[model samples]
Each structure stands twice: as structure tokens, then as C-alpha cells.
Target: MTYQNYSLKQLQQIDAAHYLHPFTDHKELRDIGSRMITRAEGPFIYDSEGTELLDGMAGLWCVNVGYGRTELAEAAYEQMKELPYYNSFFKCSTPTPVLLSKKLAELAPKNINQVFYGSSGSESNDTALRLVRHYWAIEGKPEKNRIISRKMAYHGSTVAGTSLGGMDGMHQQLGGAVPNIVHVMMPYAYELALPGESDHDFGLRAAKSVEDAILEAGAENVAAFIGEPIMGAGGVKIPPASYWPEVQRICRKYDVLLMLDEVITGYGRTGEWFAAQTFGIEADTITTAKALTSGYQPLSALLVGDRIAATLVDKGGEFYHGYTYSGHPVACAVALKNLEIIEREGLVERVKTDTGPYFAQMLKRISGHGLVGEVRSVGLMGAIEIVKDKATKERFSPVGSAAVAIRDHAIANGMMMRATGDSMILSPPLIWTRATIDMAGDRILKALDLAERDLRNA
Candidate 1:
């Protein structure tokens, strides 16, 4: 029986009874009920009640090519009919994965030419962690396995990914985390910068924290430092211009491998194939997913640099790590088609030259609102910091509550944005045009005004 036969109430009841959603509070969800998204097209999603919402978060930071992409659907259908379920195990190979690998290699940075497949960013990050440690062990340094990450930086939700990540809330839920993963200060100058500190100076200082960790742990004990190029789930925290170059220098100085988790920033999100290229980072490994298939299918690729790939090739030995759907043919096919659409439509270039700059300028119109402390963006990803006092930059009493109010207001006003603590974030589809940007800006400003009024009354 398809869900289309059921009423919205019936569907909600069924979902509450059987479905356990990720990162959700079940009891709270049951109280509120789910807003059933029946369908989506372009950059908007429609509820079962037929309310249209301009998706500002791109369906949880994916869906780059927008919705209703028949090309992706057709590609998946064709691949499924031809070779639906084949495992890349026991010396078996598929044409789609092989072709996708070549395409990804051509698109990725020059150093990253090899790929390891997984179903999601979390799984690929697990692969990256294991692969880097395995590389160090094979090179006759078994003890060099500690990884340094940034506090509040999100990697994923798996045990290793959560441990590599530095979210205190996630760590609290985790009974215990993987050992030897240390976290340092992030390069978020808005909150962390000292009074009168320059962005460049703060960036260097943040990079220095990585060096300090290596020194404290002994460089020989540190294998790699993994981080998101732009901390997406951690409030779209884009580092300063000087951050990545300094971090790269530090990693090179201590012979530490630089791992980039580009789950949210990959594809056309950053006006480039990968955030590593957007930021000029020379990463040893890049864990990518999300927009790889524009959320049409689940697929992840861990792009390995030449050095690591060469080491694995030269010092050949089974690393003993893989998933059942490592290189799923259908997912790869959808991804290939998604990449084609991104390229065919010139979405990346559009984001780079036309929409990105316009979006930033549009966001500035709302920056002067009393409730917005700061507005920051890179490419299509953006953040608006909610503040209680404009001059003092004081946040609301409960940290995230203000952003929730604003997000609710935004959704009520027919736009979808995300709330991370006190920051309202946006990662709209690459297909959004100047008109879409204007609409979003107006909706956001209205939401901000509503939030400010409500907060003042409260």
C-alpha cells in the first residue's frame, strides 16, 4: 500500500508509530506531528496541505540541483533495471562506479585522484580515519594515530565520526568516544576573536592551536587533522582567508596528514567541486557526500591524495575495511547524472559569478536588523547570528531558542531555514536565481522582524 492512499493524519499516526527519525526528539515530535513534505520542485517543497516553502537549507544541505530532476530519476531507473544490486567485493567491479571514479578524479584537486566509496558522509569519514591510520601503520609508524579536530566542528554521527567531531552535545549522547582524537579552538573569529583582533591574526592563532596540539602530543603521535573546510552543521562557520593556508603549513611542518570533511560543502555548494579547492587546501583525503547525487541517492566518495594512494599501492596489503553497498551501481549512476546536470546548467559558475555575490549583497540588507548581530556567507552557504543586544552582541538567554523562534517564523512565512544555536543558516540550491534570492531576503527580513517583536514582548 502506498502512502498516497492515506490521509495526512493517518500518515502522521503511522510515522509516529513506526518511524524513528535521526537527531529527533520522539516525544516532542509526536506532540507536534510531522510536517509531511509530499513533493518538491525547483527550490521549493510542498506539504501535504499544499503549502509551498522556499527551501533555504537545501533539504539539510544537499539537493544542489534542486528538486524534480527527471534526469537523475531516469538514470537511477535505467541502472536499477540493468544492474540493481551488485557488491564490489571478491574481485568484482562495476562500470558505473569505475566511470564515476574517473569523473570525480577529473573534477577533484590534482593531488586527489583515487576514491573509496561509501553510502554516506559518516561512513566515508570512518573510511578516511581508518585509511589514514592504516597508511601510518604501513609506513612503519603504528603509534602515530591521534587526530586533531576543531571544537563545534561536525564530521558525522557514527562513533568514529562523532569522536573525530567536537560537538559537546553529540559527545554527551555518546557513552564513550574513540580514543586519541583531540579537539582545538575553531577559526570562528566572530565569537572567538579577542577585542580588536584582526581576522588574519585570529586565523593564524587558530592554526597555531593545531601546531600546539601536535607539539603537546608529539608530532610522531599525531597521524592527521580532520576538519570541515566550512563548518556547516556548526553554524556555517566559514574560516578566515588566512586560516586554511596556515593550517596547511602547520600540517606540512609536522608531517601530519590534512583530512577534509566536505560532506556539506562539496559539489556546487562552494562554487567549486570541493571546498578544499575553494579554500586552496591541500588535503590528504576529502570525505564527500550530500550533493554528490543532489540527495537523489545516498553515495559518498573519499578522495585520496596521490601520496596516500601511492603508499597503499606500493606497500600493498589488505586494509580490511568496506561496506556492503560500497560502490552501489544505482547511486553512482544518479551521482554521475547529478554531476552532469550541475555541469550542463553551469550551476557552479553561476554560484561563483552571479548568484553568490548577489546573495551576499542581499543578505546585507537584513544585516542591519536589530536582532541580527552579524551576517556571513561563502558561496551559497550563509549564517545570520541572532543577538539580544545589537551593540553588546549578547545572545538570547537559552542560547538556541531565539534562532528556533526565527526559524519557525521563517517557515511560517513560507521559507525554510535552519537554526543552529543562535545562528540562522542557509544553503539554498545552486539553481536559485536573482529573483529567488530577493524573495528569500524579504522572507528572512520579515522573519527577523517577527522574531524581534516576539522577543521584545517576551
Candidate 2:
């Protein structure tokens, strides 16, 4: 565990020899040295080469408590000393999980009364799939089993979650996705809009796609429709105002459960505690993770509403679905502390009243930029779509590479960000300030300028 004796070159060689990274091309990664970060503190990371980089993506859109919170660490240590691990299965229970569930119920969307624990966002969503199917089975309508998701939405990487997620690349790699899962067009007005299409009309048209899909699939066989409120990792596409309301009405018209995947948008990222609240959508089930522990520990939760819980309890005797580490005490302890920090610091309120507005205003400045087509944001989550032509909104011919170059340029300028397709995305730590925002905005623009110059030269 001692890293002091090793040089950076030695570490890189060891990594190349032994490590297999996730969501990476192993052969290409071995050819290029991976930047090994040794430590992180307060939104800044120090790599093995001792270079500091400001983390603008908030460590994969988690780490909302920022980095290096000793309180969270101490909380985990304390819980471990008392009890390292325990399962929620077989009537076994722990205080931490029980307490965390209560807290989540109090904090999550209204009418949601029960919590099911998992180890990651993926597992939580996978749990959602099972619960919906189970609930439908309990209702004596096992035929109602199809699920609908939005195109380009990112849920998680597990079989069911990935199938529910609408990334075509991920789906194609996995081959035939989990049967009964379908996707509708994302309400991306800027990209999918017809010539002279108004935002309102476009939103209604987009929202109706769900109803159309349900009817196509036969509503009697459709169980649930899942989507992220702000569609994170799908180029940070924020839907139009008319979208969620119409979507809600459609879900109700059929007896389909409306599940909101709040994995990224939960815990103050969306200014509201959950994106469902922000968008005024009534969700029968909600999946949350990431900032649940602020990346201090691996934990996730699936909050079940009263109707679903009642069905499960009334018809089911023994529940067969749960992870071995579903309610790990240490993870629960860390999550408790993370929630406490957010509450005590008033981070969510600050995001709602001050930081969210400041961030949005700063983002809006890019709206008039020639290379930028749109600057969309809600609370701390945002994206700037890079366009080749302003009026026509023409994207780069080579596609996603230009955005990747902008991301690299940002990193070179000592900032961390993620870009997808032609969109440069930002999801700063919830503890971010006006000063940090100003610096990050400048750094982002600098990267865009470099990308623009490179495109011109090419």
C-alpha cells in the first residue's frame, strides 16, 4: 500500500500489466499512460506526477460533498467498528440501513414510503425493474411487463439498467437488449426540432412518443416507463417545460408505473433534492445513488411509493430480490453523514436560491458565441453544445471527436470535464462557489477556443 518508494513510470507499467479498466479499450489504454491520481481534496485532485486539477465533473457526477470529507470517513470507521456488514435478507437488519431508509423516505419524493438498498446506481435501477415486474405480477397482470425509456438517456451498466438506458452504442455492444424494453425520442428541441418548430409544440410531439409506444406495445403488456428528469449523460439534454407534465398524464392514462431514475439528479444536483420534485412529476418509484453518499461510499436506494409497497406486501410473502451487500452498515453510515453535511451546510437551499442562478447566468453568456449552439442548465448540471455553424446548428463532420478535444484542452488547462458528441458538459461539486464557477467557465471557454482554432486549421 505504500506508494512512496515507486516512481510514476513504475506505477504506469504495473497498471498496464495488471489493471483492467471499465468502459475503456484495454489495448489502447495500455499504449497510452493512464493519469493515476493519488489524492483528492475539496474538488481538486493530485495525480502521481503531482499536478493539481480542478474537478468540474464532480467525480463522475457524484462527490457532491466535495472530496476528502474526513467526517464521512470517520462515520464509516465508527460503523465498521460496531458492525462491518450485515444483510437485509432473511429478517436480518441493521440500524444504519433502517435509519438511512427513514431519512430517504423523508427526503425523497412525496408518497414514496419504502426504501430498497443496493450497492450502486446500476443495481438500484435493476432493482426497480424487478420491483415493477413483481408489483404487476402481484396485481394478477403479469402480462403488463414492458418498460419504456428515452433515447440517449444513461441509466446504468447492468443488464436491465443498460437495456433501459437508451445509448445505442452500449445496446449494440450487448446485442439484443433485455426484451420488452423500448425507447422514445428524447425531447431535445435544439437537435430534433424541425425548421421553425416552437418549443411547446415540439415538447408535446416528443411527449406523445411515449403514448404512441405504449399503444404500439399494447398497454396491457407495458409495466413501467422510466426516465431521468434531466437526462444526464445524454448530452445533458434538458427537456422542455411541457414535456414532463404531458408524460405524467400519459403514464396515468395507462396503468403504467412512472419511475424516475434520479441517480445523477438527486441530492442537490438539480437544486431540488430530486429532479421529480423540480419537474413536478409524480413518480411511483425512484432510483437514487451517486451523491447519496457523495461518492464517500458505494450505496444506492430504490424508493417505492405506497401503492407499489402495498401491492408487494399484500400479495407477497417472501421477497427474493436483494443484494448480499444491500444494506451494508458502513455504506449506510457514510450516506447518513453525507446527507447530514448537505442539510447542515444548507447546500441544497444554496443551490436553489444562489448557486443555481449564478451558474445559469454564467452559462447563458455562451448563447451568442458563434461556435456554441446552446447553453442549457438546471442547477449544477449543464452542457454547452459546440456547433460548426450558428444559424444552421451544424455539428462537426467527424462527430464526437471535437468535443473530446475540448475535454482534453480543459484537462490541459488544469480542469476536469466530460464531453459527449458535440456537447461539453459540467457537473461541479455541490459545494462549488461563484469564484469556482467563474474560473470553470473561463477554463471551459478556453478549451472551446482551442477546439475552434483546431477545427479552422483542419
Candidate 3:
């Protein structure tokens, strides 16, 4: 049975005693208690207290088709009854996984036709890292194993994923990460751009950092350069137009594989099936998750491009990596239905044509608020920089504190947004409409006004 029989206080007591959350401070959590999300529908979630919250972050940037999708539920149920569980090992395979892989190939970029499944983005990323290195090893260049990533880029939380990522805080706790991963400057123009430098110039300069890393590591020693098309957990930092093309050019020039972590940007987050297509990146591999099953089930697919797939098939044998839940039948079934809904409803096109543009326009209404330094968006993904001085783009001291305050205020006002450092990020459901955007705007503006007052009083 669910927690429905227990009182809210009882549930909280049990949770604080036994449950441990990811990336959370248990001491502080014990003091405040957990917010119980009892149910969700459309773009709104309901807590145990019966408070209705507009999920502006789309339940950790996954719930693309929104909550309460009965079709996805039925898909999982049917699959469970039919082929509950099976392993692809020992020459055994399941029909659901096979069919889902075919569907994913059709939806992925032109060159990406093969898929390696896992249970989460972290697992898929681990698969990508191993596969890329394995490809080089099989090609008789075992020395070419170093990977270049970006500072502040969020890939996932696994050892390999964390090593490939550039978050300093996560690295501090890692004690020791996987070796041979290097980080370069990200294409974040707002903070990194130099005095009087155009966006185009900054992008080129950022891309040059990749080339510099390759040269530093010796191009022959570098296996691949991996990055998110739009830095997602890195505050939805969208790169300038000149950024990706130059990055692609540099990787191509050096013959280094270009891997993309689209865990947060895949499945129509950027108005396309994949952000690589949106940004014109000819990636050799694309790691995807989160929205693949719309968070209804845990699943991730590492879309393998022809170049790497061909090498692995032709040269590499028994590369030796995968998970038990890799291509899980139920998860794959849910994902297929989720994709069907996305296509049937034309959610991708909707984000591209209608709601995406309107969402940006609505954000502009509050961009001039006292607490807002800048507001930016692409498709349904957005970020609002909170600052102490608007003119100088000066942030409040002790980064992330001010954002936490603003986020609390936003949640109390019935909006669910994420505070990543000093940036308020939003990646609402693809199903969110103009009306939902309006509601979110009103609540956000209220929170901003409250935050301005709170900061001034402090």
C-alpha cells in the first residue's frame, strides 16, 4: 500500500528517519521536513497539504508530455503482463526493446542508428565513455582515451559522468574521479564574454578552448570531446550561433569524436527531437534520458552514430558493458507510448511554433524587475539571472543563497522553479500552453517582487 493511510506528519517522520535524498543536506532536511508530492496532472503537482503548484521545471526537466498520461500507464501495464522481465544477455532479446530501439533510431539524428540502453542518463553516459574509449582501443590506438568536457557542464552523477562533467562542488566530494577527463570553458556568453566582445567572437573563443585542450592532450591521445548542446543543469546556458559550428569544425579537424549529452534536451525540449539537430552538431554519439519516457519510467539511450557503431561492429568484439535494466521492456514500452503522444499531439512543433515564442515574450514582462538581471529562453527552456546590481550584472554574495530564497518564495506562491546557483531556471512541460505561461508569469513576478523586498531589507 502507498503512504495514503499514514498522516503527513507520520510520513515525514518515517522519511526523515530512513530516506536519504540525492544532493541534499540531511541535517537541514530533518529540520524542515520533506514536501510530499502526492499527485500530479497536466502541468500542476499537488502536495500532501493539498497546495496546487504549477511545475515550471517540469519535474526535474523530464515530464515533457505532462503528468497523468493514462496511455503511458496502460503501455507499462500491458508490457508488464506480457513480458514482465528479461535479459538481453546470452543471445536473448525482448521484442519491446527491439521495437523501441527502431523507433529511437528513426527519431534520432541521421547518422545515429544504433542504441545502447540503460536505466538513467548517468548509466548511458558511462556507456558512451566506455564505448568511445573502446572504439579507440579496438582501432589499435588505446592511448587515445582522454575526453574533453566543459566547466560547469552537467552530464550525470556516476563516476564517469562526474569525471566528464565540470562541476567543482561535485568534484570536491568525489575525492578521486576517473582519470583522463579534461574540462574547458563553456559557451556561456553572459558571464564569460570579454569587454566589447561580440557574442560571435566569444563563441569562437570558447570553441577554441576545445582545440587548445586537444592540442594540450595531444590530439592522438584524445578520444572525444563531449558536451551538452545547451548546458542544461549549467543554468540552461544556450550557446551563441557561432559556438557549435566552430566546435564541430575543431573536433572534425582533429578527428576527435564529438559526443553530446542530451539527457535534458532530448525528446523535443529544444523544439526538435534532439538538440544536436537544433544546433547543427554532427555528433558521433548522443546520450539521452529524462524525457524519453517522460519520467514515467527510468530509461536512457545512448544513440550511436554510424562512424563509431561501424568501428565497434567491424573491429571491437564483446566490448563488455551494460546494465540489467538496459532496454527494460516496461520502460521501453512507456517510452514508445510517450513518443507516440509527443508525435500525435505535435508537441515538438507546438514548442517550436506557438508556446515557445509566447513563453519568451511573457518572460520579457518581468525582465525589467528589480531582482532580475537578465531573462533568456529557447523553446520551453529558460533562465532568469538574479542580481544585486542590474547595470553591472552583479550577483548577491555567497552564490546560490539568494536564489534559494527566491525559489522558496516562488514555491510558496504556487510555482515550482529551480535555483541553480543564482539562476532561476524553467523547463516546463511541452504541453504547457499560453494560459499556463500566463499563470506562471504572474506567480513568478510576485515572487520576484517579494525577493526584491527581502534582499533590500537584509
- Deviating ranges (above 4 Å) for candidate 2: none
The residue pairs found clashing in candidate 3 are none
Please provide, for model 3 over 218-257, each residue's C-alpha lDDT reduced to its tens digit, 9 standing for 90 to 100.
Answer: 9999999999998989898999999999999999999999
- What would the per-residue lDDT of candidate 2 be over residues 1-458, giving only the tens digit for each residue? 68868888898899899999988999999888799899999979889888988898899999998999999999999998999987877788999999998999899877998999999999999999988998888788989999999899888999888899999899989887889899999999998989888999899999999999999999999999999998888888998999999999999998888999999999999889998889998899999999999988899999899999988787776667888899899999999999999999999999999999999988997666667888999999999988889888888888987888889999999889998888988899999999988888888788888888998788
Q: Extract clashing residue pairs from model 2.
A: none
What residue runs in model 3 are displaced by over 4 Å at the alpha carbon? none
Ranking by lDDT: 1, 3, 2
TM-score of 3: 0.99
Which of the two candidates, 1 or 2, achieves a greater TM-score against the reference? 1
TM-score of each: 0.99, 0.98, 0.99
* Candidate 1 wrong stretches, greater than 4 Å: none
Candidate 3 — worst ten consecutive residues by lDDT sum? Answer: 313-322
The number of residue pairs in model 1 that clash at the backbone is 0
